[model samples]
Target: MKECPQQNLIVDYVFRELDTKTKTEFEAHLKSCQSCQQQLREFKAAAPVFQKARRIHHPKRPAQNYYKTLKENFYPSMSLAQRIHEWAADFFLTPSIAMRVAQAVAMLVVGVFLGRFLFFQEPIPVAVKNETSPILAANVSDQFLRHYLQETEMILLDVANTNPAEDRQILSSVKQLAIYRQLMQKTILCREHAEELNDDVLANLINEIELILLDLCNTEDENLIETLQNVRRQIKDSHILLEINSVESRGI
Candidate 1:
């Protein structure tokens, strides 16, 4: 069957973020949806693992120039003022970081006006072609790909370290489940965008991780605890994290 339209809403269902009426409708929809059931199952299985992960993590970053590379991709020809302003606006778009409404609105307006003025002031010369900067573009693209790969690796590594016997009980708590659901939602976006970019290597690794998340989210079947135990084993066997490190060093 094709993926369910209600798939994204399942996150809300897990977190109790839905209103009474919407929750009622979602529960009804959830019953027949095997895809969503799998998502829920994996979320349950992964919750405690993620909860424990707060105390365990390794910070990994790509080249420091990645940000500079990202900025170059955005406003290669724009004036400095326009470029700086838009970069600031990008931070406001991040939901994790709070931006006051008044500040965001003012910055947004300034950005719009600045952008319009910069691009229209002079007779717009035909933009230069990428023949001179193909290598730069490729570096930038790979930088983004590696950044995402590192993220998936860290999250999976943390999930893998969880012990099924102890974490199984914690998985059932409402709070743990909500956090797990949120992490999975972030994973969904990462996986989807990677696929859109046709980065098969990164996408395939993430898909393996997604399979585990889906299986863990919905099941309290204590019988599946064995399956949960194997989650870490599966990640190590895949050697995906090592592969990412290799790629990074090789400058892919």
Candidate 2:
């Protein structure tokens, strides 16, 4: 069977990340996919308004409890099967092309998650016209932002926990590039919202996360393995995930 390049391109389109030729091609097919058209409409409707939300978190928002939990189970346990799979995987795939392979494998592996909605469906549900209630709009925007952050936390946990390869190891055929790209867009939305509202802590952590995510999207391989390892360490070292966890844990 032939493949649908539009699948990946659609996510890019919703985020306004596509090139002219690709965007033109996607629109040509998009005219036929009623489902996609509906999704795109919702995406456009929810965006700019959410970006304008002045207050993303309330004054008496929930406090952090996960910081203690994080300190206790800093390196949470992983299942034996997952451990074996990752370990054996390291042997078969080499360093140079790990990302390329991972990109291919990720497309298939993450389909269950992305296919169901993440990649193809419209994620933002808020309407632009209802921006009259600033608090409500901010809450809605924060909900989506939390969802994106949690997903990224899980992916980073896997990348961090997976057994390290000496030179070239981890993150190949392991997950899809489209997934990170989607997360990147979400993070951007979250970061912009965070910055505009003077939420410095959230903005800073998101900035750190964006750095790693961009690397994942670009697959920069100069010090590839080391870079990934550093990303893992940074997650813990910078305590960015912990901070995001704190915000999310308190349901902020």
Residue 1's C-alpha lDDT in candidate 1?
44
Candidate-wise lDDT, in order:
0.65, 0.69
Q: How does model 2 fare in lDDT?
A: 0.69
lDDT of 1: 0.65
- TM-score of every candidate: 0.35, 0.40
- Per-residue lDDT of 49-147 in model 2, one digit per residue for the tens? 877796577543353455556766785666899888877686456434876677778778777777777567553422331233233334437667777
Worst 10 residues of 2 by lDDT: 125-134
Cα deviation of 62, candidate 2, in Å? 99
- Candidate 1 residue 114 C-alpha distance from true site, Å: 63
List of clashing residue pairs for candidate 2: 102-172, 102-173, 106-175
Candidate 1 clashes: the total is 15
Query: Which window of 10 residues has the lowest lDDT sum in candidate 1?
Result: 124-133
